[model samples]
Structure formats: structure tokens, C-alpha cells
Target: MASSVLQIVSPIKGAPKPIGPTNKKPMRPSNQLPQSLLDAARAIEKVPFHAEKHVTFQPPSRVYTMKEIGLEGCGISPIATSEPFQLFSQEAVQQCRAEIFSEPVLDKYQFSSTFTKNMIRGISAEDAPFVHALWKSPQVANAVSKVAGIELVPAFDYEIAHVNVLVNKDGEGEKAEDNVGFSWHYDSFPFVCVTMLSDCAGMTGGETALRTGDGEVRKVRGPTMGTAVILQGRYIEHAALKALGGQERTTMITPFRPKNPLIKDETVLTTCVAISDNSRLFYDYCLYRAELLQERMRLQAQWLREQKEAGAPFDTASVKKFIEEQREFLDTTLEQFI
Candidate 1:
């Protein structure tokens, strides 16, 4: 089979360089990888992952609690455990995580990297084969499609799916309980996929916590080795359990949303695009616009809430200001992206 060719386009200079605390190397194209590695990625994309396993569906036990956790979808085990995982070892996995999370987004958002300083920055999907392998994996893509109920597309808006590593730089912090956890909020997309990368010795805590919008919470210990989870993105709330012992908690996040040119409320479609596909360049251009739009809407909503609270006239001028600012930001940002 011909190798998949992803023509990467960027907003600024040349291709995005590999970013991290220290690494300044520019990323090489996929052509640089060994042929066997490329073949493995392609092969995984053509077959069914988790074929031996049944889809595990979780129906809500209660119905009245719609205000809090308002989602409806089936939960399934992760898709790409069998083949791709066989290629990585613990040491190799950690190295991959270190390199990938060096991207700016994950490094800033992940708390463990914030407090202890194990984070890197400027990571792009273009730079990492492990990430690309998962993105191109048929097992993962198909699983996302089945759960999302639509044909998912590869995203190009951003590096949408990624991994997080919370390992100790030295052996002293290798226990599970020492990792930082995230706050409870549904992600921005319609579907979410998480795979546990490290589970054996010194890794503890870091259980997956699920919740409804109504505040019901359930905790499940993550799968060892190749175990994974896929869930509805909008309706359920989730957080990583606080790491307790001395180990670090590491996992990969793969989120899918509608293809670029998204219509509002289109998340109703389960399988969309993975958000970093090359086709999504235009779509990603729109994301900044959408974010600006959302910021304006939020300001309007807040103004209305305040007006009601204070028994005052609605703040029309404030709303107008927000719109103007949003427009300016969108215009400037779109020029850069396009």
C-alpha cells in the first residue's frame, strides 16, 4: 500500500518545529520513519480493534437528572490495543509522551506539568508517529465511528488527540498517588477516547471518574497496559482521580468533533472528524471564529444574568462592545490562520 500522504500546511513560518522545554529540532516528515513502523500504522488502520471484545454499553440508571450530566451514548472499551501497543515498551512510551506533550497546549493545561515542571511545549501531530499511528488506526477510527454513530473525519484544526504522561523524572516520584488530577468538565467535542498507557509497577491512583451533569460520580480503575475507554462527550462529566501513592498517572486523550464548517449544535453526530486531519485546515480557521463568537455569547449571557439580578435595563451597549471586540479578534486571527 502507498504510504498515507498528509500535506501539512502552517500559518506562520515553515513547518512547526518540535517544541518543548529544551528540544528545538524541527520535525521530520513521516518518510523518515522505518518501513516496518509505517506498515504497522497502515495495517492497524484497516482492521477492527477490540474484535474479540463486546461493546460495553452504559445506560443511565436514572432519568430526572438532566440538568447536570446531560449525555446519551454507549460506552465501549478502547479500540487499538492489540497490535500498535505491541510496538511500545514502558521506557519507549515515556519517551514518546515526553516528546509529544512538549507541545504548548497540553503542557499548559495539564496540572502535573505545571506544579512539578515535567512538561514540554510546541508539540504538533506532524512530529510524532505514535500519535499519528493512533490517529490513523482503523481500530480507533472505527471504534470512534461506532460510538459516535457517524463517519469520523481526521481533524486538521489542531492536534486534537494527544497523550499525557505524569511519570517521575527520577525514580522517586514513580508511584501513582503523586500525580495531579483535572477538574470535572465535559470536553469541547462530542466524543472522547482515553487509553491507559502505564499501569504496572509504581503506578497507582489515576482511576477514571465518570459523572452525570447532576453530580453522580463513579470511579473505575483504568485498564492495565492496553486497556481503553470511549464515552459520550456532551452528556457525561469526568475527571482523573487524584494520584495517591508515589506513582505518576499517564493517559492519552483522543477527542472527535464535527468536520470544519461546523453548524451549531452539530455534535449530535457521534462520529465526526478527529480535529487534526489535513482537510480540517479551513475548519480550524473557523474554530478561532467560533471561539470568538462563543466569548461574545458568554458576555451577553452574563450581562442578562446581571440585569435580572439587579432589576436594571439590559446592557445593550455592553453587548455591542463584546460583538465589536469579537469581530476584530476574529478578523485578525483569521488572516493569520488562512
Candidate 2:
């Protein structure tokens, strides 16, 4: 993937560029949440995550390819988006919801941003044990990787089970033009698994609108409760459409990057800085990048040693290319520190 392709485009018009940590104070949702929402949260039973019981992986009904979406030769993978597919069991969803709505999580992790009013992020393993273990489970990763057409891992610990919450007071749905939960923009991470945490029994128009390569719009059905949709979000310009007839719509978004250390990482902090605790975000980002660099260097050195032991002449061009790639990687990392 070229650096140009990964450039961050602001989702909202006139959005200010991220300086450092803009969210100095704890920002809460503007409106008071409905009592029903809180009551429902308190009703769910909490349980430790057990993959065998929680994961009910099923292949998606349909997967759109980059070519089909007129975006061939773009993105890190050939697959573009997937139709809603069964991912978690109903019990699993309830457990996740309980964790997300717990008092501790709400008090500490709630984040509000210009892009979305209410979000719950930066939940650590200690804060939400079930949620953290769910994303880290091999079963979940394997299912997502199968749909993604590439091996992937969670982007980082801080991003696991990032929640987006929306509550519509009026029974009516917003007009199409006004239904966007997230405005049009590419994701900072290479891929994302969007799982619905709220029921969508009577919901309508909660689809993902994707912009095709030639500028046409395509809508994919959103996942229902306990289901998920896999998307190459970093390469696709898309937005989340609000669902009608549902009082609450909550979704978990877990970002992913290719598991291979050598794969190009286009992760950026543009979209996260404004909504995140800057200290934690920078630490997680830097640590992961450094680890990737360490592994890459080890691999390169091993290859060089093998070549020399085999009596092969020094491949100056190959060595120089590796050095240049690492230099660019380091440069990209440095740019995110601001």
C-alpha cells in the first residue's frame, strides 16, 4: 500500500487538525441517557468469556471484493466488505453489554468526539476482562481473518472492543441525509470488525454505505445482534447509517492490522487523538511499532546470514532496499507522536 492511499481524510468538514491530546477534560454525552437504557444494562448477567460457548462463527452470506466494488488494486486485501454474519452467541453479547455498561467502564472510559457523540474506548483487560479476552481469542481472530482474506491481529490493546452508542428518542428514523452516525472517511486502521451489541429486531436502514471506486454508492446490510461485518475500512470510504425504530444502537468496533511483521502498517492517530487519552494512545502506538521494527530487523538479519553462509555474494540492492523501508517505517512512526 502506498503512503498516499493511507492519507487521513477528515470525516467532518472543517474538522480541526489534531495537535496533541485535545480532550483534556472528561467529556460526557450531551443528553441524559434514557432510564430504560440503563435499566436494560443492569439486567444482563455477567459471565467470564468462554470461546466454545461465546463464539458461534459462521461464514458471511456474501463478501464483496475490491474488484466487485470497482476498487481493484487498492487496500491491503482483495476483500472489501462482508454481509452480516453470525459471530458471537446471544449470551456472549449480553456479557459484553454488561461489561460495557458497567459503572466502572462508563465512569472511566466514556469518550465523546465530534465524529460521534458517545463512545466507550481505552478499556483495558483489567477493566473489561470478558471483552478483552473475546477479541484476543484465537477463534474470533480466525473467523475475522477468514472473512478478511488475510491473517490479522487486533491493532492494539487500547482499541479492542471500542464501543459506539446511539440512542434515538423519537420513534421515527432520521432522513437518509441525516442518518449518518459516522461521516464519510477512511479508517485509521487497515481493517475493522464491527459487531452489533444491541438488538435490531425492528430496525431499518442501519446499513453501511460504501463509496465505490468510480464514485457510486453501495450499501451493505448491517449486522444484527451477536453478528458482525468485516471491512477493509482503511481503504474504503464509508459511513455508518443510523437505524430507525430502535431506541438504542450500540456496536463494538475492533481494529486490525496484518499479523505479518513485514506487512506495511498504515495506522494513523488522526482520528483517535481527539477522542483518546493521549498518553496511553501514544504509549500503545509506539510500543507496537517498536516491536514490529524489532521483528523486521531480526528477519532481515537472519536472511543476510543465511545468504552469506550459502556462499552467495552480498546483495547490495536487497540490503539497501530493506534499510530504506525501515527508514520510512521509522519516519512514519515519528510523525504520529505529535
TM-score of each: 0.45, 0.91
- Top candidate (lDDT): 2
**lDDT, residue 274, candidate 2:** 76
Model 2: residue 70 alpha-carbon error in angstroms: 1.4
Local distance difference test, per candidate? Answer: 0.42, 0.83
Off by over 4 Å in 2: 1-26, 175-177
Query: What's the count of clashing pairs in each model shown?
Result: 32, 0
Model 1 residue 39 CA deviation (Å) reads: 26
What lDDT would candidate 2 get against the real structure? 0.83
81 Cα displacement, candidate 2 (Å): 0.7
lDDT of 2 by residue, 1-338 (tens): 11111121222222123232345444777865577777788798778899999999999988999899987877778899999999999999988988888888988888886677788999988989999999999999999999999999999998899899988877645644587877888888889999999989888888999999899999999999999999988888898987888788999999999898867777787778777877898899999999988988887777777776777777777678778778877887888765
**Who wins the TM-score comparison?**
2
